[model samples]
Target: MTARGLIFAAPASGTGKTLVTAGLARHLRRRGWRVATAKAGPDFIDPTFHALAAGKPCRNLDVWGMRRATLAGLIGELEAHADFVLCEGVMGLFDGTGPGAEAGSTAELALMTGWPVVLVVDARGQGASVAALLKGFAGHRPSVPLAAVIFNRVSGNRHAALLADATARHLPSLVCLGSLPADPGLALPSRHLGLVPASENRDAEAVIEHCAARIGTSVDVERLLRVALGSTLSAAGKAAPLAPLGERIAVARDEAFCFAYPTLLEGWRSQGAEVTFFSPLANEPPGADADAVYLPGGYPELWPDRLASAQVFMTGIRRAASEGAAIYGECGGYMVLGEALIVGEGQICPMAGLLPLVTSFAERRLCLGYRRATLRVDTNLGAAG
Candidate 1:
């Protein structure tokens, strides 16, 4: 099934792309359209907000992290399930891994899927200059398909009109969907890892609803839909990215371990693996019948006390390890499997102790990038080099 979709992108970060994308998704969903949402890159945070707004799981389409067939297969899955798919861009529209590289950028996704981009421009500190910004992006990569523009954070009606007039004069061919006026109420709370996950936010539904109402009234929904290009992707043969850990895999889920990729799990299921989930936050452990356990990354550092007190969960994890179950953890999950976790001000908390490691969050440092590694021995991930 071919689905009409568009990528909600921006000239740069903080241009309100996430909020606008969520708002528009909710807006379309409220109007009785089946909306499927996705995030452009390897971001775990924004997709949660998108899922909340769309009332379905939001998948990530990473050009770098995923294979071409996997990306095509995901888009095909979304298309079959929805009337419209809204994808929120990462960082900036053209920003990717390295200097002047478009490998993993939203533009690459647009080119791959043949979905047009609705560029979200922050109109807070500009008048006619908004036109120049539009011109630059529209002409930046001609093949990327910049179809429309949304002026976000406009100060007033007069400011909106100025943006409209400027766009009309300079880039008359470019569709200006409309402007979202600056409203403090439309803002979502943020933490060190970007916007707080929707699961942790009690007001997530309320926030989505508020955004829907505001954006529905402000943005030109009909015009936006009219400009949305049908996805050029076709369903690819189902291929798991990696072999399943075991016949039955117990996955750790909840606030502390919520960074598992949907595609990875789905891929495992496609390969005839039985997957189940348990919440460590609720003192739950992996299923007894499972032969493998996966602990994904999340905000475990923030819930040190709760995790330390999860006696049952810790015991179950230890039992799994003793039973020779294939156990794997990454990032926060790795922290949880350690002997001790050092929270703020040197507060030491006991952990599962599956690994002889001690982790600390006393002074956080941002360590972001890509890495390539070769295994020296047999591990849960793969065999030795």
Candidate 2:
């Protein structure tokens, strides 16, 4: 039926949307409420944290990558599971691929799914101007509604009071749910890709709990819940599976290869396919009986030495390739499939050399964008477009 949900959004990146969303998920879950989580875009890393916080597998609701039917199917599935669904939005509330485009923005998601947004503002250096910003965002798109505002990185009670009072004076209809004070310990560690995936964060659980405690004390969880539950979203329905890759697919999964989406794998299973996991980082290869192999993106450059020296793992991959097992890779996995990978300080590490491709991490370049590729020939992904 109507699954109460909220999309955690911000004015820009680094506005503490992930932290607030995760903390609120944990806090609400601990208070005996079933919580489901999702990420607004195609982010593999943030969904892991969302899963850890909500104590369930998190799904990705991408506006750009996913078809409307696919999104509807996922929303149906989410509605089937929990009382509340907290989706953390990408980058900024209105930011997307191009100027005036809403394809991948949080605003687009809110407009599509009717999920009210809980905007988290970085209130470090502003006061009454915060009201103007909120008013602009709230009025920017008539179709999308801003449910509440949570001020993050507030200097102190004095700063929080100023922000709250100013917003109340200007946009009185908007609710100030909470204000998180500046805390160094609350910040998560980051690297070239982003925050270290939740699996590698040793203190991840403790960090979630600490954030939850803070959120529980500071945020108006009950009021926010009311706002979410007030929405009249339709019930989730049955979904058909996507095009099948193979009957038995081998998947790479580990700290070094942990970027695969849960929904994709779940879709594979729904199509009556068997999926097995092997860790190249652990020197394990794909199962001998696998019909196809999939390698998702991750930070393989960080573990060059270990990946290079995994003789058993590398040998098995070569054997599988020789045996005509269809293999595909994306980004990091593509790097591993190449002849060599150049990591830090010009240290070139030997890879499987399966493909005549060369990738260098040492010589970094920015290739950021939404990519569209047409099939050159008929392949597992389907016929040429």
Candidate 1: segments with Cα more than 4 A from true spot: 235-241, 378-385
| Steric clash count of candidate 1 | 0
Report the C-alpha lDDT of model 2 over 299-366, residue by residue, as the tens digit. 88888899999999899888888998888888889889999999778998999999998788778786
lDDT of each: 0.88, 0.86
**lDDT per residue as tens, model 1, 1-385:** 3578999999898888998888889898888899999999988989988988998889999888878887887888888889999999988899988887988999999999899999999888899988888888888888989988999899999999999999999998899899988988778788978888888888888877888898878888898999987788745533346788988999999988999987789778988999999999999989888899999999898999999999999999999989989899988998999999998999999999989999977866656655567999987678998
Clashing pairs in 2: 76-236
At residue 144, what lDDT does model 1 achieve? Answer: 88
* Residue 313 alpha-carbon offset, candidate 1, angstroms: 2.1
